[model samples]
Target chain A: MKILIVGGGMGGTILANNLARRLASELRSGKARITLLSASERHMYQPGLLYLAVGRMTPDELYRDQASLLEHDIEFHVDPVEEFRLDNNEVRTKSGKVHGYDILAIATGSRPAPEEIPGLAENAEQFYTEESAIKMFRRLQAFQGGRIVIAMGVPHKCPMAPLEIIFMLHDYFKDRGMLDKVKLHYTYPIGRVHTLENVAKWAAPEMDRLGITYETLFNLKEVDGAKKVVRSEEGGETPYDLLITIPAHRGMEVIEKNGLGQRGWIPTHRHKLTMEGRNNVYVLGDTTNLPISKAGSTAHFEAETLGENIAAIVKLGAPVRDYDGKVFCFIEAGKDRATYASFDYQNPPQPKAPTRAVHWFKVAYNKLYWASARGLL
Target chain B: MARRTVDARGSFCPGPLMELIAAMKMVAVGDELEVLSTDKGSASEIPEWLRKARHEHLGTEEKDGVWHVLVRKAR
Candidate 1:
């Protein structure tokens, strides 16, 4: 059996590692082979990008070579996928290589589509990638303390990241003794400060205490970089000396080009994680059009279920596991403190108050994540 | 027991743990090393790691909002 996994992000890599361990006998006997096709050689610890933006971590510490994370049994292909020939059970890469697989897992996670909103690419800065986070670090160092606006473009990965960035900024400025010189503002497209009601309620007083002006129901329409203004669809406008925004997120163009996505996101069964209308194809992580936070923890939990199911299907001819849509997130609350929330499709997360211990846990998790990529933790 | 102190206060998690492990390498067997960290998780995690590594855990104490963890290299 040949298992072809696309996109070597958190989901793809973790699933590959899990499969290699579970199917070790089959792999050693040449009964099954796993091939991971990734566009880049580096696998980034995306949650660390927030710390990278604030100078807490360097760029070198944020990622590892994808080859280093994969087991010897799994083959790594550094080629971009051009198209998926689902009807023929074949995948064509940009390098003109066509491979046939018995099982296909689409783990090609989403990317920030800055072009989705007019002028956003030119006006706002983002911290989603290593380069952008480094740029934000330099821009922040040169900032002279004026109005700073942090906005979200909706459905972005790591929904808690923007909030963490804002809190870290507060601590950064306060440490520099310029807290009073700068005014902080946050705008979200949703009706509340956060998608989770419990989190928003817990964060309301904290935002007020930090002197941050929180605005909701502000959908980003256009950015006027020259005028240093961001206008909402409702004609609401906010001006800033610096703008840090999370751009709109969409699935990879390759998936969309192959007509596999609904509005650029792959549609999958919420619990089964199987691609709609396909039995052998499964989808997980940020690429799926699930109403869940596109965070690493979500991918981690989903991988657990999907990995088990794949193993069962390959060996027993049927899937025996189901994903619960459970997600966990650690929200950095500044002052070296953090909070965590965990929930699934059936239960709403009860907000836990921020604490110093939680902050340390987030920090420790970053190190554990590297081990996890190698299937050691 | 003479103890050498490794002050890792204000450093993030794994930072303190890594510092403790590095400090352990420099110390002679039976010598104690104390790590001071403000990262709250280290208060418990350091000892857990020490136990796994077969080091003698002297215990942990919080002083002035900082955690002081002591361990003696056994191997």
Candidate 2:
């Protein structure tokens, strides 16, 4: 069996590591092979960027060498796939090499497309990338503090990020003793404060307690940088001294170019985690249009199930289980306090009040993410 | 047979639970397993999983902040 995993993000890394471990004997006997092709040599703890934007974490702490995180038996390469030939069960890389696979898992994650909205990218501070995160931090530092507006668009990759960043901003400003001078405003594209009803219920009060004002049903239509204002699709406008945003996200261009999915999100079978029509082709994480949060833990849990099933395919010629739509996310409420939501298709998460213990756990997990990529945690 | 103990003390939610589930697959029916976790979430989640998976719940105890959830493979 030949397994080709594209993209070394959370889902791909965990799946590759999990499969390598489960098929150790098969790999040793030359009965199975695992090859991972990634666009970069480093794996990033993406959630750390939320902290990075707020100066809680440094850049160096968010990365690990991708090769070092993989098992020794796995064949790893930095050649990114340029073309996907699903018809041939192969992919062509940027280096003009074609790799064939008996099984293929696509984990090409989403990217923040602030460029989708006019003036939004140029005016708003976003923290999706290393450069942008640092830039956001610098912008936050120089702010004289009037109103810091957090505007959001539909389908942001990490849906919880805008909320988390807003909370962290409260702490960051409080730590700087600028709480009285700064007014925090948040706007979401949903009917509620959050898409998750329970999370909205929990967070609305938290926002109120912290004196953070919010507007629901507000979408990022455009930003008029000259006026220092953002206009919503609902025909409302909010002025800001500083604008921080979680822009709408789109999956990789390669996926779109390959016609694998619309706007790069492949239609996937929710329980099977397979491409809607293609059995041998699998989709995970933000690459899948599953109507779930594109959180790293969603990818992690999906990888766990995909790994087990793929390993079973090698050992038993059939998969044994289903994905069950499980997702878990830790919501950082504010300074030294956190809560989490764990839910599936059938269950909606009712996040309890924030606690210091859960906050510490999130702090610990930031360092432990490397172990998780290696499928140890 | 003595009940097997899976020490997951340092791991958090889903980590300890995933470890326990992975270990359960290797054990035989009627085999007992104990999951030791410090995660408050997993301590509660494990018993719920046992109930849903139709496994026999032995007991759960918390000592010094670590939760010990015991179960027996029913099928």
Q: Pick the DockQ winner.
A: 2
Name the regions of candidate 2 deviating beyond 4 angstroms: B1-75
The residue-by-residue lDDT of candidate 2 on A183-285, one tens digit each, is 9999876455775667888889989999999987576779999999999755779999999998777789999899987678788887899998899999998
Best by TM-score: 2
> Candidate 1: where are CA atoms >4 Å away?
B1-75
Whole-model Cα lDDT of every candidate shown, in order: 0.82, 0.85
State the local distance difference test value for candidate 1. 0.82
Interface RMSD (Cα, Å) for model 1: 22.1
